[model samples]
Target: MTVASKDVGMMTMIENGNEVKRTCCSSNSGCGSSEILVEYAGNEKWIQGVINTPKGVVPVVSTQLNFSDILGSWKARWGVNRMNYKINPGLYAVGTPDNESPVLVTANYKSTFDSLRKELADINTWILVLDTKGINVWCAAGKGTFGTKELLTRISCTKLHEIVTQRTLILPQLGAPGLSAHEASRQTGFQVVYGPVRAKDIKEFIRRDMTATPEMRTVKFTTYDRLVLTPIELVEAIKVSIIAFGILFLLNLIVTIPFGLDDFYAYVGALIIGCVITPVLLPWIPGRAFAWKGWLLGFIWAVVVNLINGWPQLPSYSLVRAIGYLLVLSSISSFYAMNFTGASTYTSSSGVIKEMKIAVPIIIITVSLGMLLILLNSFMGI
Candidate 1:
């Protein structure tokens, strides 16, 4: 069989005792394709047989990262191609592996799968991907999709015990949140092993006799990692255009001149400040809670807006409109910050609940007051 796409090219041949590979050559002798001959188990089933009724077709057991996978990763960052960007939830072989090869388990999220397989390019292993609904391991564990139940279920469904000689299964460290190691061993009879925090360290972990270094045990969210998430947040904020457009329409009706664009710009600016800038600059921003950090940024931006509008005096615009912008814009920023607590690290469920109880009520009150003031100024001809 021959497989070709814009990003990848490959040919496959499965045969008897002799190694099988197709040498790709054009009419000319300019280009030559090297034959990759892997000696696989004759008793083992076809590479495709591992799929069963899995959602995705198994890509001919490869460790090389495809250009298409990198492209898919770019799309996932912007929240595009996120839902279907996943591998089939089942057992798979990285290269030709005997029963003694180590078994590694991971989430079906394509990026995570690619990262793991890419690091183990030279090492032959069994990869058992769980159905995490396309979420990364950490988030999936938090949501319970990467829990002990699904792990045991997949193990049973795939008949893993019958395939591999060893009863040890290595899992990503992030998946520990929802998994009870003892409970899993008690039920499945397979020993659970938590591997390194990052895929890059997996090779080292295995080479050092399945031992993870202290550095590998720690999880760190760097600035770049934090920055990438802002794009998705900004895009998600755009989905609330209905309410924003409604408010803009009302503002257009109230003002005789073209103040609609000004108000709209201010609205969009608030979104940028809240969703994009707030999270990107989270560490530098002052305040323990996300709400206050957002509010501070919003208040500062509101002041800048006021200065642009001639802070001291206004001929046509009322004091209420000026005050209204300050209150409303700051509140919008604060709301975005409060909602973003889930995306940040070291935040507890009970702490988030505690913050929401206090922050939500205050945001509601401030926003309502700002809107009322703007309407009252419009009606009274201020």
Candidate 2:
């Protein structure tokens, strides 16, 4: 069959103990053909051909590579610190696709492909990888890079029409913003079918014949999901934590009597309690705002400190100093907890900004007043 330059051609041939011969010749050749031969083993089901180009001849795979192997190789090459090499975003074939196999569409990002394949073990499907420039589908769709135009262009470039018999292509639900379903069908013969929001749900979605219920479309931020993000947050917060703790410790040492190691530890503990623990346990801490939750946790920490350190029973000046430290620590912790909303998916950007504006001033005022009161109490010998 003669395939168009913009078409990807799929052919099935049967051979009986002899190699099938074929030739490819460009129109530029005076003989009207460049002599090339395709040797198909008698048992071989398919053969791939590549047209030499300026850069190099690119290999065209007739059979799909194992999805797990593809994903594993990608992770090995690009996982942790190898961020320099940009991922290739374009059409890729997954599994051994026959003319009738289901076509699954995905973003070009290696990570996104890995996620989809890793979750879809034992499933025989064709993956039509779209060029999204290394971004996930949700973000790419929002940026319009994964929009209808690219989809149509890719379909033409890959000659997907020649490979699959069906006229349907499965896309991720999050990509709906950038795709015009009606326009896609008009531009390309293929009709668009939006899949589930998450790749993990694809198996079940396919079982249900590509129909996504409301539950499949919804995005949830459960505690476990939130907790998975904590490590990154902790790593990012380390620099700020160090500077804040150093300043607070110095203040504690200078304002109080002979500098003690215990005082330094207490100040450090307050920093962690406020910045880390408070944010994680935010919802259960009895307040709608993160600052209030931090304050509540801080108050509890103070009570525990008073009991353990016997600070309440200390001399008047020392008791006052202890109270000052606890109050300031609590205020700081609560304030930092409020910053967590920015990283949370559940919190809107506007809501986070609003919380920060209101909470920051309260934290500053309370911590400042607590420090000032302690100094005055020390001077008055109260």
Candidate 3:
């Protein structure tokens, strides 16, 4: 089949193959075409079959997610090879879409793609998947992977013009940062329409003649939303704790003392305060800066630990240990909480950089002093 539209061109040859590809011609040629090959057991779970289009046969996807999809999403949340959780980027059909069907665009991240398709269960539409290196739409947009260049290149490579009669493509509202709608239209002859902020609101947005309601446009970071982000943080913190435990063990050996269970519990408590407590109580915690919030909780926790260990009634070394724990645990918690800015909607790039400039130096100084105190007390009996 020969496909041509606007400035796009393509030729499809259906044969025994496991996947579809849209290869671009050399830039030196001053033109390019999409080459599609459909039929692959590898994508059988998501791909139901194929629908014959005027340009070629497009792989059809089920709108309902299966058990594997749910499990994969869970694994990704826990940071299990999350970066590898992506699909091959290309054009896909949701239901039996025709040329006049509404075309939606999304990233190649499997979870993001799944979220969109599951919401489109009853809608006949075309999904244009962009390669975003396994990142979600918002992050990819910020990183420029889901920008105007990739959008135009994908449009040409997929010969999207020939596949659909409509000259409009709907993109997620969150992806607006990296792309220029006018530039895309000027280059590819397709109008870009931004949809709702959430995939769940997409059906309603489309039903209302593609007009997004105010609620659909507002991005909310609710308790549940913030809660879901903690799993990965918790998992990563645990991994770091293992290495930290090893380092602590070596340090204790150097000081000729056994690594105490109280010290272990204290450190673990700091990790929990940073990775779990701080995020859960984010808004309620009396601070605008996440580092300050975490440090407050960590300081409180250190005092409680010292009180329980009877450090106040013990020797001067015990007092030094209390002070050391306070500084070190608070610093650790602050560092982790600062890193959470990347996952938060409350922080901007400039704001985070400014906060880091002030916080990082303080954290480093406190941690160094704390470690020095602990080591000196152990080594010199001070």
Candidate 4:
């Protein structure tokens, strides 16, 4: 049984292309459509309606994303409201699904949920959302928020046994790291089925008796995939750049060190190389370690900076300052490039740790020495 819902509040919000008002109403079976109108008219608007069942009322959601959903996703990509961008972690209905419908599990991250549902435009399925603390499936799985414990607890809380007749729960393949299939099945009486790495393949996966092709299972981190993630990394790098720039500016005011346009250009160039260039050219870069790739590019950029300033030929230029520029630029680029380890699937946790052990000390020593040389050059006329 289902009750159609209408927008009762005067609050203006855009859905699809048209402006519409939204209202908050609990999907509990006790409340009628009329009673819901006057109960509580606040500003929560994600759920469209409800489907009453033997267990409880499951909130119905649209497969199509609205204007607000689109805006929120864009804001999240830029690191704005990133942690807060999530839906309520619970069972939801897409289209008019029955107890026999397949259950697809995913994280509560709004972007992940949006990606899953948008591809299910023609499919009628029940979505089981796990509380991943606004993290995507792959990350949350690594962090353990989307682990076996959370899955068992959510299944019990949602009374999934009563809501659906199926004994299988389809989970994203990336989330496999955290969940032990046998353990979850033992605890919840539901077998786990691993789905495709990408959400777009969900339709085909389901159409083929819940089996995924080899292509569907394969995870590809293409250039476009790496490119989209750069914005957030760049945004974080910019914050650090502001602090570094201020410190350099203060040094110029207090000391005789020549910190000017050349220095600023070199810093920004290194920042870009680390946060954007390294990721975009990841496959083509000569080294296995991201830090090494970034350092090489940053070193080249530092050379360009020196060339622009007419190094060696210029009588006033100090070799100490020139060497310092190379070290600082390369180190800064290496640090930022290492930050991409969390965002990429190319490196394992152990590999990242090993790289850090070898790279971090060198970076610290070189940067410290570089800064000392830059300051020492001012005093000794090196």
Model 2 bad stretches (over 4 Å): 1-86, 107-111, 128-165, 176-190, 245-283, 315-320, 367-382
Ranked by TM-score from best down, the candidates are: 3, 4, 1, 2
Tens-digit lDDT string for candidate 4 (53-88): 666667777788889989999899899988878765
Put down candidate 3 lDDT per residue, 224-293, tens digits, no spaces.
8888898899899899888978887787777754567877898888888888788888899997888898
> Which stretch of 10 consecutive residues in model 2 shows the poorest summed lDDT?
30-39
* Candidates' C-alpha lDDT: 0.73, 0.61, 0.80, 0.80
Prediction-by-prediction clash tally? 0, 4, 0, 0
lDDT, candidate 1, 194-301, per-residue tens = 999999998899899889999999987677777877887888888895677877677767654434566677778888888878888888998778888898999888
Per-residue alpha-carbon lDDT of candidate 2 for residues 276-313, written as tens digits (9 for 90 to 100): 67766666767677767777777677666656666566
Better of 2 and 4 by lDDT: 4
**Clashes in model 2: which pairs?**
8-159, 25-33, 25-34, 274-333
Model 3 lDDT-worst window of ten = 1-10
Best-matching candidate per TM-score:
3
Off by over 4 Å in 4: 1-46, 379-381
Report how far residue 208 has shifted in candidate 4, in Å: 0.4
The regions of model 1 sitting more than 4 angstroms off are 1-60, 254-259, 313-316, 378-381
Q: Give the range of the ten consecutive residues with the poorest summed lDDT in model 1.
A: 30-39
**Clash pairs detected, candidate 4:** none
Note each model's CA RMSD in angstroms.
Answer: 10.5, 11.0, 5.6, 6.9
